[model samples]
Target: MSQDPPRIVIAGAGHAGGSAAAFLRQYGWKGAIVLVGEEPNAPYQRPPLSKAWLKGEATAESLALRPARFYAQQTIELRLGTRVGALDRTARQVTLSDGAVLGYDRLILALGARPRALPLPGAELAGVKALRGIADADALQAALGPGRRLAVIGGGYIGLEVAASARALGAEAVVIEREARVLARVAGHTLSAFLAAQHWAHGVEILTDAQVAAIEGEAGAARAVLLADGRRIPCDAVLVGIGAVPNSELAEAAGLDCAGGIVVDLAARSSDPAIYAIGDCTHRPLPLYGRSGRLESVPNAIEQAKQAAADICGRPPPSPEVPWFWSDQFDLRLQMAGLAFAAHEVVVRGTPDAPGFAVFHLDAEHRVLAVEAVNAPADFMAGRLLVAKQARVPPATLRDTTQPLRGITI
Candidate 1:
């Protein structure tokens, strides 16, 4: 009698899960590969959803990470419009939403995060939306056009990107932020101020230090945002981009360790060695920062996919990647690397008002902790290397545009 081949089951077909399945094949995993997702479409790029897709510049086909035929060619089973309903750790099996029971030798949890909905009254109105999937993007895109007024409830990257896209579509945009400045939680003051100026230059109204008391609606559709200070800002639609919460309930129910997200090791392994977790769903170890945190970015997703693949294939692990992120707003291309939480001193490479500039965050030891480059690819590349190398350069040298970043090392 021939023995059955070992099967690997992947839950969630987002970037991380899709990449994991591809990497497993590349890393010589000949066993059965089943990639399951709740959505009807295959894995696709998400960054463009808030920008190009919303602006009607990109199509659904353009956002795909891989074509529909890739899975068939690779012998990987693609299960679309299906979700893993229940996980049995003891039996090493999962119950699908379609009432199918599938057993696996190993399971990969790549369940991504969902938008954090607002708690204010009238938040569930027809015109109030949050973008996390293609359906949401389509709905939000329809809400934007010439003469439309979009009131963004958060000043984060998604909200700002939508605001920029709305402006490009000849619509009016207003950003409401509770913080003292835009991008306060994720970026340094220099970059935030510069971005604010760029948005203002593009005719996007920004209101900072503002609190939303409720979302007023007319006939079950959002009509205006009411502020705690009695200010009523009328809008055609409302977009809430505050943040996201990890889809870790399934993992938590299966008795896996979960904090803000699923707690995972460097190898993306969960509490149960037979199960691994990756992407935005995992609160993974950040070796560079000497801590653990959740990183919601494409780079982070791909990195964890590689990690999980290597472990399963008995291949050598890939080197830890420097955490990085990017955003597109107006005509600006912002790229950032590393964490700036513990930085003591900040250095600027070029004038903020200039077309190209880089903001560097350094610890007390003058070690480069993070870098934010706006339309400055050279600075972003060099800063990434410096951060990975943990290089220390004098703050004055960093401020000197004449001193090449590639040559500056102390």
Candidate 2:
């Protein structure tokens, strides 16, 4: 008699989980694959939730990574609206929310992250929301309209994006950031200043170093935001976009090593060889920087998925790519490649007042550390290549836009 094929169970059917399934099949894995998700909808791209989707520029069907028929055609089992209650590491089994237990020869945890909630008073009031899923997007969209007011309680990407969308819908938008500058945590001062100015030019009020004491509401519906300085900003809705907390509870319960996120190796393997973690849920080492950190970008998710698939199939993983992220606000397209936090010098390639510009971050040795491109796709792409190759270039050449970026590489 022929032996039964091994079974692989994936938890969290988001980008990471869904991509892992598809890649596994592509890698010729004939095993029984099952993907379990807490959300009812199929896997969809999330970046659009705050921009295009919120602006009514994209449809629900257009957001899906793959059609429903694709899963059936690939013979991949999808358990939508299902949750994994617990993991039995010893037995290599997972108990579903409905009390059904499934065994797996290999397990992948792609349990992404959730929006961090504000613990302020009146936070639970209606009309106060956080955008994380499609449902949250729908709620926020309904609240945005002409003559309405939206107070965003963070200066992060989501908050800024939502503020832009609200403004586009003719709603008065205000961004309250506790830091000294908007995007202080992720972006450098140059990019931060540019974005702040962009929002201001678009008539969206931005208050940096502003603290929210509480969300004041009446009849359980948000009416205004109270600041630490005793000033009140009246609003019809409030969006809390402080950040996200990784959903690594299941991994922790399963006895996997976890810190800010589940600790995984470059191969996306956890402490246990049979188990792997990927996407925003894993804090893996960055070969480029020789440091370990958690990345919350779609490219990181897809790359990690491919790595996990390779590891599970006993194949060599693909070459590691430099980390990159993008944001769309108004007509500005911000693309950042690599981490700019530790750069010693920043070189501006184009005039910020113009329609296009790029910021290149370099170390003492003039090695390209990161690049922030505003409406400069060519610069962003070249910067990504240089960062991945660890190329060092002359600062003067980088600053000269008239010179071709590819020829100036050192």
Candidate 3:
């Protein structure tokens, strides 16, 4: 008698988990694949939730990473709208919230993160929202329109993007950031200033170094934001885009090593060899930076998915790519490559006042550490390569506009 095929059970069917299922089959996994998700809908693109999707530029169907038929065609079983209640590591089984249990030979955990709550008084008010999924986006969209006021309680990419979208919808927006400047944590000073100016030019008020004390609500809805300095800014709604908290509780319960997120190696393998973790839930190895951290981006999720698939299929590992991220706010397209943790020098490739520009961060030895490109695709591409190769280039060579960026890599 022939033996039954091994079963691979994937928890949390978000972008990372969905992609892992597809890649597993493509990379030669002759096993039973089961993808389980908490969301009722199929996997969809999330970056556009604050930009194109909010602006009514993209449809629900368009956001689908893969059509519903694709899963069936691939013989991949999708168990949507159900949670992975418990993991039995010893038995290699997972109990679902719907009272179903699945036994697996291998497991992949892609439990993504949730939007961090405001933690202010009235944060639970009806009109105070956080954009993390389709439901949140829909609620926010309904609250925005002409003559409405939106008080954003963060200066990060999601907050800024939503503020821009509100402005486009003819709503008044005020961004309240506790930091000294917008994008302070993720971007360089130059990029921060430029983005701040852009939002200001678009008529979105930006408050830097301003801390929010509490959210004041009228009846059951958020009506205004109270500042720490006793300033009250009235608004029709509030959006708290402070950050995200990784959903690693399940992994932790399963006895997986976790810190900030589920700790995983380059192959997305957790402490347990039979189980792996990926996406925002994993504190993954960043080989380019000689460090490990949780990266909450689509690119990072896809990259880790590929890593897990290759490892499971016993194929040659894929080359490590430089970490990259992008944001679309107002008329700006910001693409960044690598991390700028210990940079010692900053170089400007183009004039900031111009239509396009790039900021390059370099270490003491002038090695390309990171690049922030504003509507500069060529610079982003070249910078990504330089970061991956860890190439050291002179500051003057990078600043020279006459030389081609790709050719100056030497």
Instruction: Score each candidate by Cα lDDT.
Output: 0.94, 0.92, 0.92
After TM-score superposition, the amount by which residue 222's alpha carbon in candidate 2 deviates from its true location, in angstroms, is 0.8
Error of 2 at 197 (Å): 0.6
* Cα lDDT tens digits for candidate 2, 230-299: 9999999999999999999998988899999999988999999889999999999898988999999999
Q: What is the lDDT of residue 314 in candidate 1?
A: 96
- lDDT of each residue in 166-252, candidate 3, tens digit only: 999889999999999998989999999898888899999999989999998889989989999999999999999999999999999
RMSD per candidate (Å) reads 1.4, 1.5, 1.5
**Model 1: CA > 4 A from native:** 1-3
Model 3 residue 133 CA deviation in Å: 0.7
Cα shift from native, residue 313, model 2 (Å): 1.3
How well does model 1 score by local distance difference test?
0.94
* Residue 382, model 2: Cα distance from true site in angstroms: 0.7
TM-score of each: 0.98, 0.98, 0.98
